[model samples]
Target: MNWFMEFLATGFYSGKLPKMPGTWGSIFAAVLAYFLWPSNPDFQVLVILITFFLSVVSSDYLARKLGDKDPDQVVIDEVLGVEITFFLLNPQGDLELTLAGLILFRIIDIMKPFPIRLFERLPGGWGITVDDAVAGVLANILLRVIGGFL
Candidate 1:
């Protein structure tokens, strides 16, 4: 059960990487988003929503079990974060847009500015997952707003 919890938390070992585990989890997320999410916008949104819900629960459970405030090993949150970016911004799976969202998400996620930082202080899994989700949303909005100018 401990192994299972870790497995779910780390996004199947992506987060176990010694360095930049969160980034590794996001990379895993990008691949999953590219390959698995349905082409239909509505179905794609559903998939993203489902993944996010599961990730939150998994993260909470792992954090509590692992006895960490927000276990660094729990990077399913990163998957949720990046999924939010791609789902909200590039539902069609445009490679360029997806890549852009990835870059923006990484920046905001790592920087954790303003409300992103605020979100990180929430209780349990909410603390672990929300900061990145907000970052993804910020990235999605920023990308869309910037795309408008291009």
Candidate 2:
């Protein structure tokens, strides 16, 4: 079952699991966030912040061990990024906001704007994960601003 563990850890089977692994991972993370988010807004914000930070650090290492430059199979970064976006919006479990946040995270991640492209140049798994994290941060700020106005 060693192979199975590697497959699961690397998310290699993610492609056959239904939706794109990146998207599916994000959805799964969001569900987790929904359950973990505290009733107190301050605590929820703290949880999001900590989750984003840990996701970046851990995914970086995991990507390197799994090999491949930004492997499609490694999607925890996407999960964390989408979680960061939705958390910033403070959606109160609104499905519309969740969908929008997912779209926004995916778009920004694909676009790789500005410093995000620069971050990708860093060596190893840091290169793999940092760019996406930056994209997530940017998307989070934009969503927060938009949420403020609405």
TM-score of 1: 0.88
TM-scores vs. true structure, each candidate: 0.88, 0.71
In candidate 2, which residue ranges exceed 4 Å CA deviation? 1-19, 39-66
Winning candidate number (TM-score): 1
The alpha-carbon lDDT assigned to residue 8 of candidate 1 equals 80
Worst 10 residues of 1 by lDDT: 86-95
lDDT of 2 by residue, 16-80 (tens): 35547676666665565555545566775776566555555555565666666666666666665
For candidate 1, the lDDT comes to 0.81
Off by over 4 Å in 1: 88-93
lDDT of 2: 0.64
